[model samples]
Target: MRRPVESAQYTSGQYARFARDHGVRLSVGRKGQCWDNAVAESFFATIKTELLDRQSWPTKALAHKAIFEYVEGWYNTRRRHSSLGYLSPAAYEATQETATERAVA
Candidate 1:
């Protein structure tokens, strides 16, 4: 976890490089602002609320597996998202595919 101050001080290139090194992407907002990451913050909040807050795991491994299931199997595959017209992410992706096929046809 990065401290807010440390994260704020990192240049875009440095951050991007660090992300690349870690095999993760960093969507850093513009400098001198915290509100730019509202969407990500909201997602984390949802994850905590719906998944983490609802259960207690006895071990780190169990917690990891539970979070993985929540994110991959439930949230991405089945949860309705208001931002996507109340469709799950998988459903939204399917709709996008249909739209692309219709456009091609």
Candidate 2:
């Protein structure tokens, strides 16, 4: 079942507000862009396999904390991704920043 359009719009608007407050550049692409969704699907799949499927959470609060720790502690800082030249997300981002700074200089 699909969500009501009004509810979807409300959620999207809330996300846009949150993104703006966080200085996030939201990627608005034309419809039918498989590439845009693929990355997120891959991440969700990996997280499901690694964290969600491994154990059960007694409480939503605990689950949220675990998810936060998994992403921040291990996934971003240490997990090597093939698409990122086998570098962790944090390392890849750092390199990208350095490259951008050098190009600007």
- Which candidate has the top score in lDDT? 2
Model 1: how far residue 86 lies from native, Å: 1.5
Give one digit per residue, the lDDT tens place, for model 1 in 7-77.
44455567778789999866666676777677578889999898888978789999999989888999999
Q: Go through the candidates in order and give the C-alpha RMSD of each one to the true structure.
A: 5.7, 5.9
Tens digits of lDDT, candidate 2, 13-46: 6877988899997785544466876778899999
Off by over 4 Å in 1: 1-7, 10-13, 16-26, 32-36
TM-scores of all models? 0.67, 0.70
